[model samples]
Target: MTLDCFCGGVRVTTVKKPEFLHACNCDLCRKSGARWGYFDPSEAAIDGQTSSYRRHDKPEPAVDVHFCPKCGSTTHFRLTERAASTFGDTMMGVNMALSDQADLVGVELRYPDGMAWSGEGAFGYTRESRILGPDG
Candidate 1:
């Protein structure tokens, strides 16, 4: 599926639906208003110009969040150079909020407690997971 930013200045094309979408309640994710769909960098293709931000709150942030320079819409995220060196740049996350509700029907939505996460291992969920419906 292909998704575009508000101004269509940035686009992301995914080869397949994400296994699940993460509705995280972390400082960055909350402020950015992004519902993350994780994929291998190879599973998705990104087009167009973007500006990116790496978190300053952490001494070594894991990913660099990218947004459309024209519309200021959060687009996708890639591993930071430091993070890539340690973890290998195998994963990327697209902001699924860019997708139409109908396009994500039946997609599982998971709520991860990012705020409480230690950034080391699995995190507890703030709530149970649910599948998106036509109305969502």
Candidate 2:
């Protein structure tokens, strides 16, 4: 599936469905309004140019959030250099909200407690997870 920015200036194509989607309340995810779907860099392809932002609040921010320069819509994010060195380039996040709602059927949506995450391990859920139905 391909997800495009609001202006269609940037596109992210995924070869397979995400294992799950995260509705996180982390400062960055919340403020950016991104519903994240994870993928390996090799599993997806990104096209077009984008501006990116990396949080300075944390001593070592993890991802560099990218957005379409033409429309300011969040597109996708990659691990920062520091983070990549530690975690490798195995995962990235694509903004699932950019895709057609119909494309998300049967996908699991999880509410992770990103705010409480210590940045070293798996996240706990803040709310129960749900599977998207056809109606979405």
Candidate 3:
């Protein structure tokens, strides 16, 4: 699947279809309004220029959320060393809203309460569709 940012400044191409898509209800996610498809950076080719942001309070390792500066659209996110160690590989949260070629059938769609992730791991997640997974 190939995705283009609102301003066409960012582009991402996935070698294979994503297995999981997430709809998170956290402060950042809620405001951004993007459903995310998760994949290892190795699974996709992400090209383009984007601006990044990260919360300072209790930040996620070196995770950086990136967006198209021109369109102000959230495009993707990348994790740093710490998150990579815990999560196995560096994963990118590709914004599904930006892509028109994504094939989501049978893919697991998840609703996670990112606002209250207990660290014991998502105790408040619901498998909303055939599309969200931890298989990443």
* TM-score, cand. 3 vs. native: 0.80
Compared with the true structure, all predictions reach lDDT values of 0.95, 0.93, 0.75
Residue-wise lDDT of candidate 3 within 7-96, one digit each (tens)? 788898888766767888877777887788888788877788888888676645456788888898998888866877887676788888
Top of the candidates by TM-score: 1
Q: Stretches of candidate 2 above 4 Å error?
A: none
Candidate order (lDDT): 1, 2, 3
Instruction: Judging by lDDT against the true structure, name the best candidate.
Output: 1
Q: 1-136 in candidate 1: lDDT tens per residue? A: 9999999999999998888999999999999999999999999999999999999998879999999999999999999888889999899999999998999999999999999998999989999999999987
List, residue by residue over 16-49, the lDDT tens digit for candidate 2.
8888999999999999999999999998899999
What lDDT is obtained when candidate 3 is compared to the true structure?
Answer: 0.75
- Return the clash pairs for model 1, or none: none
Model 3 misplacement above 4 A: 59-62, 85-88, 130-136
Question: Residue 54 of model 2: what lDDT?
Answer: 91
